[model samples]
Target: MTGGISRVSYSGMLLLGPGTLPLLALLALPLSWVQVGKLNGDVVVQCDTLEPHISWTLNGEQEPMAELVAEGQNLTILGLDLPATGNYSCWAGPVLLDTTYVVVSSTYEEEMDVTCQAESYHGSFHCSWPGPPSAVFRARLTHSDGSVGLWVPVAGGHGQFSVSLADPSFCPFGEELRPLRLHLEGLSDTSYLSLSRHFFLRDIVRPDPPQELTLRWQGEQLHLAWAPPASWQLPKSYFALLYHLQYELPNGTQVERFVEGVEETQVQVGAQRVRISCRDPYTPPAWSPWSPWQDLNAPQ
Candidate 1:
């Protein structure tokens, strides 16, 4: 009975103290909330100035601006929720200290570009764009002068293209100039590019001159002989040789035929009066003027 009475008196004395009750009530109260800042999206950015009252701008508009209230050296904006298309520039204060460009994601189409190296012959070029798997690609090649050409369709994803050109005259011009045009159609988006200051064609070795020209006698089928031209250069520079032989028939129609690997400069033809023509293998081969019809009737 005495112990219970003592315990109740101690409890009453503890409640009577002014500091104890207030301290306990203070401990029971909830803590104040702390603020945090974060940023999102894949776009990279660099901040110039560090100060209070920092702001953000989307496509150079202040209405969509937001203040960075959090206290930290580095702040990140998470999942940048932007509109269809915009050039996002984040600025701090009135001076527009930091600027950045942002192009909104497109659902319909996208494009990528590549600058080829100098060694690229015939002007190297590359282009890529995101699309559905196994989707076809359509491309159009144009000149800087705004001349449009045919569109070619090719397989999807990154691709390679190359071409060469020559003059119409078929002369030994040594070099030619023209920007090659490769066009593609059947793509998901309508993307076009006019490649300029790029290589369209490259220099290739000149072909060897004609060879193995033969002359013969049509009248007695005798005294067959042949000789090489004096000015013709021997041991041709090119790896291969192209040759041809020509003869005129009785009806005045000319018969001509071409042969490969004809290293020999001269050959013997048949019959009495026959004319033979020879020429170098032009890139697009051409026949030289027919030689004077020889008179095989001369004594051997």
Candidate 2:
């Protein structure tokens, strides 16, 4: 061999040997390397070892605590406060394992409004709210004594539900607690959702009964009149003249008369000299203890 080229006698021909066999062998061997890439949110890549130095970049900045796994540890990169738009890249085993579009969020918040009304009964409040179907909802009441009542239910559905107190016992303010509280189930298991404002329960009261019942003088026309009891709080909407008046004559005789919307203190006496009493229409003469009878000619 002369210079850098060496010739060898093989068979009848001459062969040339390369100058740097050791350097060529070194170039042919593969070295371990990871490809560059990006990822957003969460990603899992399986590789030979968990001890690899995982590095990631958001935009061009390096992630503070990037983790790499071998046995496949879950990677959670939530709540990263990423920009509205950016590039996220990560690497695994000398290869670009992940590349994702970073979408910054303005945050998703929902507002719920609820209104409650009392049914026909007292101390009971009903709440109606709007929400999703298949969503679990709960209600809790705070009594006046600083104690909490167990959650109650109204109706459960996707669009709306009616929730109310389990009993009047949970009503702290009694009839005074107009509207009640309603708590919705938040997305997180441990959190609670309460309506921003409270509603008032409807107070439907009985109307006043007639007063100053009186008997008037008319030749053959006896008229009766009376105002209702004053303590009545119910509305006129429910008020109806609902009583039957009966007249009894001096001969131990009786006459039944029907009156409609009549609160008159006096009724026309058809012909007989008699005494009269009144009874509620809904209650039969048997059920009602008749009102004291008034004699037309009786002295005051």
Candidate 3:
């Protein structure tokens, strides 16, 4: 009764009668400070004072003595489960001491639905995951140099959560000593879950598609030109990218070509359309999504 209560309404007339009022009241109790415990683990709730006659109540009812262990100033909850989660209050002879809203840590089969990506190897990356609609999440990074980062809160909507993180010491040109570790914790009003992933920045790199693409004809030779993705790290020599060019011929035949160490290339004449993608050459072979197709005669 002391916590916040949910507002409820009855129909135009009290068809259920007054006997149901008590049940409705019991379901509207407000929650207080949260205390999360591991599933199936014991949780000890203590009273601040050393009163010998202390007693406890859960959700406005007498605590279930058979399912718990009671000692002076402390109550030990056993085998935490969903049914064991509720507001627990400590009392001493008509005086209220403290209240704790206990919940258990849990996870579902979809808890590991996480994905990460880096646009460039300059050390910043982003990871996202799908979770319960009411959940909040925080993330941290463990860099290749063995340094850990502070928790970074995530932002999301419609059941998806994401966070961006950066490691200041990361070098785009240096060899990686270890994979970076990403740790995530998801919390809800009645439950908590945690997950982790590990990978090198280079492995997760998915550079933006090649930009400013153009086609020119000099007599019989057709030339293709494009600039590296703007998001890619500067100093092209230190952080080179490999490009893939795909085109369609007049006979409906498709041809793909790999262009490395340069952003411009010569292609066979009579190609009708073209698109290009790029990737980090030193990392695992993963190409960026193809750029939008460009028709040869559409315009410059």
- Top model number, lDDT: 3
What candidate 2 gets wrong by more than 4 Å, as runs, is 1-75, 79-110, 166-180, 186-300
Q: Scored by CA lDDT, what does every candidate get?
A: 0.35, 0.40, 0.74
Q: In model 2, state the lDDT of residue 151.
A: 51
Candidate 1, 140-198: lDDT as tens digits = 55542345644444334434332222222222223444544444322111111222233
lDDT of 3 by residue, 1-300 (tens): 112211122112111112122335335533224566777777877777767788888766784532677788878788777667666778987898876656566656254678899999789988888886666677889988899998777888557889999988898878888999998866554565667888888788899999998888766678989999999998998778899999999999999999897988887777899999999897898888899998876323
TM-score of each: 0.26, 0.32, 0.78
Model 1 RMSD vs true structure = 27.4
Residue 32 CA displacement from its true place in model 3, Å:
12
- State in Å the error of residue 241, model 2: 14
> What's model 2's lDDT at 266?
50
Q: Of the candidates numbered 1 and 2, which has the greater TM-score value?
A: 2
